[model samples]
Target: MRWLFPALALMVSTAAFAGADTLFVGGFQNAALARGGSNFLWYRVDRVPPDAADPVQSCIDARDPYGILANYHRAGVRNTVRTQLRAMRDAGQQRIATGIVHLRAPAGQSVDGRYGGTLIDSTGGTLHPRIRDNLVAFLRDVYRAGFSELLFRYFPQGDNTPVWWTTFDESLFQENWQLIRSIEPILQASGLSYRTDLGVEGMPRAWFVEALGQYYIDDNRPDNPAWSEYARRIWRNYVAEFDYRRSVGFSFVSDSDPVRTRARVRHLRYIYMLADGSVRYPPLFAIDIYGGGTTDERTIFERHHHAMADLGRNEPWIVAESYFNDAVAAAGLSSAMATTGRQVRYFLQWPLDRGIDDCGVNVAPPNAYEAWLRRGF
Candidate 1:
């Protein structure tokens, strides 16, 4: 008989981890890397630590389970990433864990990636070869750098600013679909099993997607039947784009307006409804749990839960980010080891009691998380 680890009841989205459910962070800074499980370093092309010294090497030194390179891609920023990959190799740590973000160059900044004028180029039924070649080149760089455990975050909230999170309209959705089509080959070529996340701002419903697709360019369809046909076709195109798993990601801002938050909930429900009829709630759903809320975490989490239950199927949700926020209850005011230790255990078990999965921790780990590993949890 094959040796088996005790069931942890941890839920991972993929079959690859058939026997184990491990902990990880969505992304992190210097402090979190020192902890354990998975570490995410923002691959900012513009800002590499001086002298090619890798920030991740130290995480490797600490022997963290995974090193995730979260790409915050900027134009003409390849060298910094390339240099760091070499640093990883020198440190004898290849194949960094990563979350692939396929986003455009925000509103301003150079459109340095393969797509031009926007994240998807001309925004029609065509693929840009230059962009495809560029994507190929970038992925090649990723491979050379010894990166693995890639999670492709579909649709970027990218280089996104506080002024705007992400605007989801009809045309952008189609373009993102095409964007996925353009890169699937390169992603496949990397020779690593990959995970994918799905999301769009406001989490628009199927009707919205249908309306936007049908009337976005032209709402002047003279006949009512023609409009229905157009809307149906549009929904098909939009839904067809999602070839990956059923998943959604949410982030909380410092804003606490109940009206706005509730509106956002409605949009997310739309996503749930559409998927329920088809993919049926892809195994993994992630939330970036931040602190310093206008509303308390408990209230917020319950509200989101109610929305899901309203949709008729509520699976275990993943707390993909936590304790890293400046105002979070877990992190508190200090980085004291003891404080975080207490906080980590309290929250991890707390969410479990509420049907949420404690998946990723942002920032660093406390002795508490380490203690779980020690106990074979």
Candidate 2:
């Protein structure tokens, strides 16, 4: 007899047991193609020039506009900002989270490069006029989308490059917050709750020092003071824009060090204190775990899991991004599935057992087994 696994039933059961907290396990599929031999496809509506065609439509007609916009905002394509928001609503995804920048490029020029294209002009001035108009249009579309939640990620992973890292200035950073303030009215009108990922690496020094204290900084000063200071300021300004005292949530990505992860989690707790004396809003702590044969990837995930469990005091945790490299290609589907399944099951059982509320799996497409795992197999 052919039997279908009651995947949704299991998910419902798990979710019920886990209470209101939901575990979001999905892939970061590429817009243009499927990964790993599965139908999972990521729809990207941003980054490409407005005049350029959407490559994913050719393969999969159905699109996740919210996902696309989230990715695009990180990539910095402002032209299609409104179009993407509308697409998300039309595609049945009401809530969305997007990123913003304090600067803009000249009219007719494209900021098509990764991590939301260059925001500053050649002379190091804000791109307020150009970006403001685009943002107004974008926020209007977001309002039209009927979204109830808006999560803004100030420092995206792609922006980890030296150029983006070093270029951030206090004035420009404050301008970004100002942009958020200007758009708050639209968000309020839409009845959306706003959250942001103030990843530890992106926070400002004063805020970081205030939150994590100088001891933590001295312990994990991987980069020079300038770079670390810049990152901290980015994090601070991003968080400062939001009223954490009110039910706003904050997220942070883990550094490679286990000690640092624990320290970051502690710091986030301090941020929670500043927000409201209680950790009401979700505290999203993510760690990058790339799965491959390399020792570095394995080490990263191992340390991440240990650190999370070590530092987790009933906070929400997510494996923000994970990639299976070419080394794992030879392992085939069965091997890959077994390994991936073991990891997922481990996180679900161990952390959830310890009272952690949420866990997310990030994957690419074309892997049927991985897709099954994501669907909660």
Candidate 3:
């Protein structure tokens, strides 16, 4: 599924008042973060940057300045992203895309703690002071790095790939959600105590915990069905607790592979069901279009585009994470640039073509993207 945090419930409200069926306004809910309308940008720095300035900035500059993506695996990445964001602001880019990413415990590092004799984690050794400091420090970096939202996707892959979870079942699902809930209080308290505007909010996961819980039902385990159903019931409760407008959900085009497509389709259906039949209630959906992994780029793009024709049926959609893959390898740099331009056209046109409240597209390859932006594609 998709993932992070920039929103939570019982906090200040920023959602706009719109009709229930409509998903976007002028292609976005928040104009400031969306930059100049609904636009997408690159997600550079999969890991930590060696320095603050990105050497590839010249290559990846695009007009889609709504937001940038990041991960918290490496501590140095925060510095690099902050530097880039400030530079963008200095360059007169008023929108100043708020960098977004996740902050989770590293692999195999079981962090446990006790709250003044109240045990925090199953593991007994990790104390409250240690947990508070580490969690606070990591979250504080989110404010320093200029990230607008955070998604606590401890398990990165949407449909339960389970990097952090030792097992892929109900037990892990329960533990992870509990941990996320616990971390929220710490995040809030730390932000206040330190006097940092870390107003960091939560992002509804695309499918993370809920999906894994669903798997237990698929596995045909007795009693686990009730457990999984109960998980969904509770998730519905929590999502209701947190205002739905502040959350965003992730989606994608169905692949030619029937297996993945079936899984995604099922997940999509569940997301809708989770909304309790309210079109306006589910987290806003972002359509992911990373082209050409196992087939022609255009073919992939078209299928995804066509598949999502009814995506608007469930909820409003955005070209959440899209880019012309293999651009550098096809023809030459200029040809790739031209191809990128065409892809950009298709994404932008879809919203106009369908006449739905298309949220926006976030395309990458900043190296060639700036040129397309100049051409007004």
Candidate 4:
């Protein structure tokens, strides 16, 4: 029987000896690509960069990560997917964790070309059929293009390869759920893969719950029967759509925020109960603590630690993304973990990412944090 924390087993077992117990550490661009052990880096699978610098090989030269968290968005074209995949193989990157950053069109926006537009039907109540067809075609192309060994957010049974999976830079809006509902079954049916990183963003806090429509149900706040019941209905739909496959799990990514952390943990517990104990994979919570150096990450992180414990479950977590170039923020994050008895399963650094020029938040080159990060790590 598959047990809970299959991904956690891979992470915790390897990291236990490190004393810090971080399973994977990595982030947006070249900074994370240089670190050893499991690391994450973003790529625009739709096109190859024209740059002369080869960061992937440099990372392998330092040490092969247990796996690479290859983050991408759903808008990528298939030809670019083939091009990028070939490039990665040529570069000698074997273990890969493929994640879609934003699965659906951002609220009020739409995607161009083959992947189609919004997933919602005209009534705004269900998934559009074309979304599933497009997704299936895209994934089949990916599977055919020499990506047989895959890693999802939840570790699948009989697959021992360890890869860290997490969502980045997007919140879990209702549309995201609709997209998952449409895509997950196709993955399972074709046996291409299972388990997608349920994107949970911390910056949105109350907006996250309110937008997710789970406020009274799993927010750990005072209950309102009507609201709680509505939340339960939503959870029921999630369970029905997911069908207890052990294929879906959580991977949080955002700048640190205590309220969001508390609500997500409690929310997971409620989900487990609603599944009638069918949900087995432990939802791994990770944070992408980003700032321009003014945010008090330490205090926020400390609150996050306590909030997890206060809810009655405490598991080793991941510092999935951070601007580790800032010495003060880095030190504060480390100290908070030590003081709170919370062990890190991974610590990834986010430096200026030159690979994807479209990224709004990428830090430009000559970053002082790069020098500081290299010296500090």
lDDT of 4 by residue, 1-377 (tens): 01222322344111112322212334312122122111222232122244526533333222211111221224444455556555544433322334332232334543321112111221232334544454455456556654332333322211111112222212222443454565566667654533344432311222234555443324534233332333333445665666443332344444344555665555555444454655343433455555443456677677777766887657665554455245665666656765776755434444333233122223211123332243222
Query: What are the per-residue Cα lDDT tens digits for candidate 1 across 76-146?
Result: 44566577556544532222233333344334432433232223332342344555554556567766655
- Which of 1 and 2 is ahead in TM-score? 1
User: Where's the lowest-lDDT run of ten residues in candidate 4?
Assistant: 156-165
Predicted structure 2, TM vs. truth: 0.45
Cα lDDT listed for each candidate: 0.35, 0.34, 0.31, 0.39
Clashes of 3: 22
Among these predictions, the greatest lDDT belongs to 4
TM-score of each: 0.46, 0.45, 0.44, 0.47
Scored by lDDT, model 1 comes in at: 0.35
Model 2: ten consecutive residues of lowest lDDT: 348-357
Q: Candidate 3: how large is its RMSD?
A: 13.2
Taking the tens digit of each residue's C-alpha lDDT, what string does model 2 give over 1-377?
00011121132101111322223334412110111111111223123232436433211222223233223354454445545445444533323434442233334553432112222221132333544454455555555655544444443222222224444455544544454455445445544454444431342221223354433343333333444454444444444665543222333343454455555544443333323344333444433333333344445544545544555443333333333222232123224333333233111101011111111212221122332233332
Candidate 1 stretches with Cα past 4 Å from truth are: 1-13, 18-42, 45-79, 82-134, 137-148, 154-173, 200-202, 205-269, 272-279, 293-299, 309-312, 318-377
